[model samples]
Target: SSVSVVICSGDSVFLEGAYQYSAGTYFDTLTGGNNCDSIITTILTFASSDSSLTAASICFGDSMLLQGAYQTTAGSYVDSFSNAGGCDSVVTTNLTVSSQLSVQLSSDTTIVTGGSVVLVASGGASYLWSTGDTGSSVTVSPTSTTTYWVNVSDSLGCLGTGQVTVTVLPAEYLVYVPNVLSLSSVNLEHTRLYVYGRGVESLELIIYDRWGKKVYESSDASATTRSDGQCCAYGIGWDGTYKETGKPLNSAVFVYKLTGLFSNGKEFIESGNITLIK
Candidate 1:
């Protein structure tokens, strides 16, 4: 009697026979049997392991998650992965750590008329000003000129500081004259002079002839006001004649003086000599 054996695909089979079987292909016959049988065995399977994953780059205060997603400050992070074979795969991810915040003045330089100054924070999530301002920006109206400082913080509680200097100048009044007096050639007849000044309460214009005789005088003159909410103490129009009589004065050297009274009880005086030419 004879027994036959057959092996299916993808199955491994081993047979003991008198003939030798090499590692490659094999065909063998059972002892004392006329029938022949074949045995086939599948090769060992080797799969490539998954490539190690890591975060490309991360900024300060950032956290990387297991699925490669990033978050801020704090979050769950996976440093390694454990495979079914109990082998742990390395996950080289970096956790950015830094302590930095940015602060800036809203208007680094400003020109205000005794008003409030605004300050702001940049690249920061929270703000803390030395002047007790907690918002992103704060307005500081100091009684006097001062240098202010601000401290800023980020979501990670990092802090930074910035400073600004404010200048408060004293109020000033300026005076301007269209033309300077020329003593050598004085056209007292058709000469019109314009005077400009600020915060003036009164103006006194007096003109004296070469003989030291008062030729013209306008005391407490009616001065025109300027558009800057300030009054201008100015006197215009001078005819080439004497105030005492409508008679032409002799062409000679003359002296003119201007006195201005300001609202603050301050006084300003200016004088010049001019020559009258016929």
Candidate 2:
């Protein structure tokens, strides 16, 4: 009589008072009830075992199932399952967890009308701004206070977002005065000390030296609209010189008083110090 049996690798099956491990045929001799020798044939085979290795990744704050367990960190893991022959079907997992996505903008800021501000975003592989811009930095000139948003993505497709508010200063009797003047530069605009502003229908500018004596004064009411439609009062700027003579003035600090009237007939006044550098 012949019999067949299957077992797993590294395991044995008992047959005819002996253990069988490898796939082969064996012969056993046993005595029958009639006292005659009986021959027994045993066929042994090995069952199929399974092993696999896999690599997986998950975003931060996310989980993945492996070996009937949830993993959230980066590392290697192993699991075992029983096959039909009760063998260990081993599975190895090499998992990697990505870092959390974070995005930061430059700052929420304020800018004068007709002026532009640069907004920057960091800690991202790609960026998309609300202005339909796709760069990490964008320039915006909003007519009014506005909020801008940016969407960022990492190489792993992880997403993050950031926003900034830009406050646009309203039109008023505004003026810009320079504190320093450079005479060495060839640029005429550099040497000329000009007070720039908007909404001024009439302007009076006076400059005084260290002494109380006034060195220059202007009542020029000439105003022109800039290309951007903002009014700029030209009013004959000073050229680092005395009004009496066309000679240049020495390097020193000078005090100035500026008074004006807006187009709406509102009064405006300001005083500041200026340094003339030769």
Candidate 3:
């Protein structure tokens, strides 16, 4: 009685099983209980470290580790696993090295009064503003409304751009003239007289004798006005004289009137009489 051994594919064997030849390698004892026979064969197969390893979904500019029995290498990466059995799988993962950069304006509002803004890039890089300015931030004082933009570039030569808007308002003020009045004179030594009005943009003065005869006329006159305090009256002064002669005329009663133009293009008139003692 001798011992026998058998070995199966992917399985080990020892001298314990009953003597028999099977579909796998076998060892036996026979031939007058003194001879022995043996056989051996090798089987090759393959398997992954993890069959459940899968692909990952992520946002742009993000990195993820590909977990698998096999180590990942640098190259173009593509997901080869198909949607089988209602589950996602990863067959291989490839990697590509890139110097990626992106730019974003500090403010989304294009119209801003006055201030500085920041232009940032995903990858730290150099920045250039629209006005030939270079820096991560730019302080701009635009005289008028303007559009500003930034150009950014990474060390790897990737480029990105962004823009913002700025607006400037105009300065203004209000102009005012209070009250304007006219006075008349009669019996004056001279037929003509002139008076200025307060805040009077343009003024015209005319004088008439008792018979309604035009005696004196003046387009230019001296005028003054009081801008502050109550009980203050604005007035104009005129010398009694005829335009034809420097000599004073005989004393008489005369009617005088005034007309004025305002900044707003409105006209005003005043009439009265004065007596001259000559």
Per lDDT, the best of the predicted structures is: 2
2 or 3, greater by lDDT: 2
For candidate 1, the per-residue lDDT at 189 reads: 19
Give per-model TM-scores. 0.31, 0.53, 0.26
Instruction: Tell me the tens digit of each residue's lDDT in model 1 across 1-278.
Output: 23333332233346344332222344444333555544443232222223364444334555445445655653334565655543455565544546445555654432334666666667677777777877877777665567777777776666677887654333454343433343244543125343566655677777888678888876544567544556663665355478736687776777887787666666656576756655
What does candidate 2 score in Cα RMSD to the true structure? 11.0
lDDT of 2 by residue, 1-278 (tens): 99888788888977767787778988889999999999989899988889999999888888888868898989888899997778889989999988888898876775668989999999889999999999999999999889999999998887889999887755764665678878786766667676777666777889999896788898887765543565673666788889847888889999998887767776666677889999
In lDDT terms, how accurate is model 3? 0.48
Better of 1 and 2 by lDDT: 2
- Candidate lDDT (C-alpha), each: 0.56, 0.82, 0.48
Give one digit per residue, the lDDT tens place, for model 3 in 1-278.
22233332233334224433233343443345456443333222222222333343332354556443232334434343434332334455445445445576664322123434444333347888888878777767676667788888777555767877654333221111222212233433122233423334566667777888776676653433333332222233344555435556456777877677645565555566766544
lDDT of predicted model 1: 0.56
Model 3, stretches more than 4 Å misplaced? Answer: 1-194, 221-237
Question: Candidate 2: global Cα-lDDT?
Answer: 0.82
What's the ranking of the predictions by TM-score, best on top?
2, 1, 3
Clashes of 1: 4
- Candidate 2, residue 28: Cα displacement in angstroms equals 6.3
